[model samples]
Target: MMLIEETAVPETALPVAQFKAHLRLGTGFSDDDVQDAVLTSFLRAAIASIEARTGKVLIERIFSWELVAWRTGYGQALPVAPVKAIEDVVLRHMSGSEEIADPAHFRLEKDTHRPRLMPVGTVLPPVPSGGAVVVRFRAGMGAVWGDLPADLGQAVLLLAAHYYEYRADTALGGGCMPFGVTSLIERYRTVRMLGGGVM
Candidate 1:
């Protein structure tokens, strides 16, 4: 199975100014604009890292998942959280033929952390014998910063500030997430993924 983000969060929705405010560098700090690039980079990194850890997308975007067959007969789990919609489902055959599965044949069931596509009546669209099925969907809590949960939003600011403050210190090494950031997203972390095991 493979998941691809079809569209990324829009640049205008970046929380640069809000993140700066969270850092409390001072309301009238001089040369604020001079550090825009650095600040934005930190913010972006924080957002990406947080999203990866939590399995929750902070902003709404399109995603495409492709797999040869459904993992189980009952349903297939969508890895990301708060999925807003399942746009389409298509089964591609080895002979280069494709079938758009009827939307009525499946229903979306959502929990707090993940959404799933379940067969509507114990009968799901058939998987192609030698090809893959593609699921296109949109997932996220919201598109803008204001739509994010207060704690999650604050968490991003805190993590970004941490990155900015510790830029010169390479003691932590790669992928070592900070304690505070992990604490904020612990509830959103997914325990089990589609194929089984933990995320």
Candidate 2:
């Protein structure tokens, strides 16, 4: 669909290698397979989003070629759900043992009238009754546009998860989740601290 200039080739390579190493060590996935999975997952998530809104399969779009190619290159789809799921998890984490009464209360909006992809410090409204939560996520251009470097893809997914968790915890009445972008930064003192390792 959209064309993106390929930048950060050198910057992305090392992190891609590190991401492969992490996946091998943490999940026992071979580097090649992990790459494929990430790409496939990205396509699936993109397709899911497109299908969710348009009720048409992504295969119908001319952009599907780019997505398919990315999937062919990378082994796994990016864990995009965690971007929103982290919010739910964090809410439950902060809410303690109380069961979340309904899933409908918590909603995840992807790319809703947002001009930029991955706008910084955007916060969604909290659901009423302390039970509902809403989150809006922008799909990465690399993932949505074309082949995203592994490192950048990982970073986007991590941020999605981090913000989701952070916002959800903040929405909760009690203390925030022990792990979030802010907490991880304060605790680990590194931006790369909250990688795809957690979810």
Worst lDDT run of 10 residues, candidate 1, spans 190-199
lDDT against the true structure, per candidate, is 0.84, 0.29
What does the lDDT read for residue 99 in candidate 1? 86
Candidate 2 residue-wise lDDT at 179: 39
**Model 1 — TM-score against the truth?**
0.88
Tell me the tens digit of each residue's lDDT in model 2 across 7-122: 22222222333433434435454655545445334334433433333222212111100111111111212223212121221122234333432434333334212111121233
Clash totals, every prediction = 0, 14
Writing each residue's lDDT as its tens digit, candidate 1 over 1-199 gives: 8989999888788888787787776566577778778888898888888998888999899999998988775788787888899999999999989989999999878766757888999956888999999999988889898999988997888899999989999888788777887788888787874355212
Q: What's each prediction's TM-score? A: 0.88, 0.19
